[model samples]
Target: MQRLSENPNTLLALYRISQAASSANTPRDAYIVIIEELQRLYDPHAAAICLINPNTSLLEIDYALGYPPNLPELAIHPGKGISGRAAFNGEPILCNDVETDPRYVKLIEGVRSKIAAPMIAGGQIIGALNVDRDHVDGFTEDDLDNLVHIANEASRVLQSVWRKRQLVMQSSQLNALIEVGQSIVSKFEIQSLWQTVTEAAHQLTGAGLCTLQLYESKEKKVSLQTVFPENLEFLDMVGDIAVTESLAGSAIRTKRQVEFSNITTPDYRDLHDVPHDSEVTSCLSTPMIYEGKVIGIINVFTRERHRFANSERRLLQAFASLAAVAAQNAELYSRVFNSEERLRKSERLTTLGLLSAEIAHEIRNPLTVIKLLFSSLDLQYPESDPRNKDKQVIREKIDHLEEIVSKVLSFGKAPEGIFTHWDIDDLIADTCLLVRHKMGQLKIDLRHHASSRKARVNGNKGQLQQVLLNLIINATDAMPKGGILTITTKVEQIERRSVVALYIEDTGSGIPENLVARIFDSFLTGKAEGTGLGLSIVKRILRSHHGDISVTDTSEHGTTMRIELPFVR
Candidate 1:
């Protein structure tokens, strides 16, 4: 002690300790420098600084020097060792003979004397500066006083440095989180966004696996969208958990964060489809809350049992919030895409309507000239005369020409239905009569039945007749070899609303599977000689009368089409 007071090295050591404490920019650096200075002051063989880990309530060797290379990184609890005792009590410990000290846990081969001083700042002990010497009684009372003073001065510098480092790290983490949020929100595809989120979560948390589970409202189920490692067995295990049973589900149900340290426990294993393995030990789950409701869950898995700190939990929650917003945006974009497709189809139909009008007008004049020439021929000249058969042939050809002109004229004309109260059954029977000849040509049997007291629909008489005509003709054309055509009318109560349903069924070779979808589309035809405008006209007339038509059923044996019109009442 006497030699140390006058020694030139003593003053040098004091100066070095002061400079180190002032220059350190982080708590870890300050700890290293403080321990290093203590070793120099006492000329110890080894040194270390043990601090309290707030989360686990344990003491950890944060920094050390001159110790065995293979020493374990962890240390005894806060009150277990000489250093831990001093740190916990905020006092200094002096041991002249370490072998006799119960608190001393020796790690060095020749340690005999030891001193530990609490590093106190803002009236709290953060850690302790420890020192060890090679000889017994090497550290005197003076050594304890001097080391305590040094530790006291170093504590203030360490706290300031630590706070600065914390701020910087927090700022960097926030910026990284913001960038991830931007990337997720920019994606319009749900699957792609989910993949990005899971990948980012795995990287951010240093976890072995990551997964996203989306909630289905209709089924009240949750489905896994993406998982790391691409493990089918693990996925199947996770899939077995009911939407209301797993940790992820708990987070969603409670609208809170959930964490598990040991997934291998029986409680967790019971809920999981696959037994927990050694590869997965810890889990963190957070709910994706949007509009005050939980829509999904984001989960991360670690290989080792880990207590997730508050910072990590907060970070995961932030990610989940961003994901919720991105998912909503993606859904909105999908709806817009479908609406645009419908509008495009409407525009195409409008163009076809304009072109058909022009062609009908141009063909009218030539049709009129042919009709006048056929009328000028006389077939009364005789059956014996060769000109008689020639004249008869011209007359029949003129009639066929007139029929073609009439059909074309009907297509180009605007719908002019005589609006009146009429029995739909009588109208259907009349329309079926007009198509009976055509139906006979194909060997088809046409039948009609009314199942309601009022088969009355408020619409144009002629338009309804036209609709019935188109349907019977189409049914007849569908079965060229003859089949059954049945028409039925009924009053339906759907969703508590009264509606009239007109059903037309045919046994003709059911509409070709591929053409079934486009049967109502204008200019879509299945027959080589069809005008392709019949069904289109039927659909337009129905829409004009505030009605809708849809295919009820189609199979190899038959096809059924249903038309629904809201009753006037």
Candidate 2:
């Protein structure tokens, strides 16, 4: 103790080791610094730095010098050997006669003297530093005190490094969890979702393998869905596990996280569906619960025996929750998509029927005139005259055509509805109110210009409202980046007839020149997801009420849809 306190060189060595250990980036770096300093100061025959494995509770040499090649792999139990005993007892040991000391376990060929000191921090012994000399009684009491001081400094620095590493790991895990949550929520494909869940869990937890399994309530079984690394043959080897058996089943039944330190041990080996693969040594399982019911299970496996930390276990539980939400979203999306498809089919059939009736109505007017005019051209000729026979055939053909038109009109007869006078301005205002929320969400600005006088028109209120609503929604869709929508209504006179005109315009990219001419044609669209039937249906509804719609003006600045109805007298 006098030599260690008086010698300036000894003080300098201690300061240098402390600096080196404190500045190290990792525990391994600190270990190397401590072992190198011990070798330089004492010139011992053998020196080693060992740490206790939290999972195994064994003192394993992390850094060594001058020892046999296989000595680093030696596992020393606490209280079993000189170094292990020092660590277990939390004290320093100086033995001059190794052959007489029953606690000494020979690691090197001819070591007779040994000194060991425990490295302690936070009131816990972490490991020990050991040194050996070839001759008995070679080390002094002063040497034992110096080694203990060096061990203490190393322990303090190493603990600091471990805390910093843990903080960094926590930050990284948080970022990974956020990314996984977003990815799982946006995607709905079952296979793709399963792949993402397994890969993310494996990478985030630093596990060797990850497996995802879903619970089937009717079957009372949990079946493996996906595995990370994709090439692992566990899919073929593993089968559906009953809800009553296995670690995964236990988690589902308990609705909590379950872990095993050494899954290869006899206690877990006999469990059904246990992964018996040699590479898998430890396992952590978390149940996927949604709405208080377990939907699935997530399991992460480690290649070496490890006790899962609290952080890792919590991260797995979070991942399981995200997986459950994703599965439920996928199911809902499927049902909605199927329902939308069926609705579209029904709408198409209804439109076809309406168009058939409209065509028949147009043909009946001209057919009636032709039939009446032909009968008036009666000629007084004999039955053998060819002209008379030709007239007879023409009359018969016209009658047959009239019968066909009547059948078509009857098949798609429009129902009679009450028609009342409505001010165009009030109608447009009500329609805009319905879509005000949508417009606000899209950042659109609506500007309505009512007429100076009431432009009243007689029409079915419901059908007219449908026309205005369709036009408003279409205008909004055109201005995807949120532009201005202007609606104006006024009374006008065209060819000496009074009419009410309503113009709906949008400040959007103009319709393509190729599409403008056929804008109201059925099944013609400018949008990727458009059905191409909205404008066509709107035009038909307007025509049925003695009104019409047309694209009055179109340019790069925008498009204007004009609707004209006869003014009520």
TM-scores vs. true structure, each candidate:
0.61, 0.68
Error of 2 at 421 (Å): 27
RMSD for each of the candidates? 18.5, 9.1
lDDT string, candidate 1, 144-180, tens digits: 8777767776776677786777677668768878888
Best candidate according to TM-score: 2
Identify the leading candidate in terms of lDDT. 2
Q: What C-alpha lDDT do the candidate models reach, one value each?
A: 0.75, 0.83
Candidate 2 residue spans exceeding 4 A from truth = 1-7, 170-186, 217-219, 231-239, 266-272, 290-293, 325-340, 356-532, 535-569
Model 1 TM-score on a 0 to 1 scale:
0.61
| 127 Cα displacement, candidate 1 (Å) | 3.4
Residue 214 lDDT, candidate 1, scale 0-100? 80
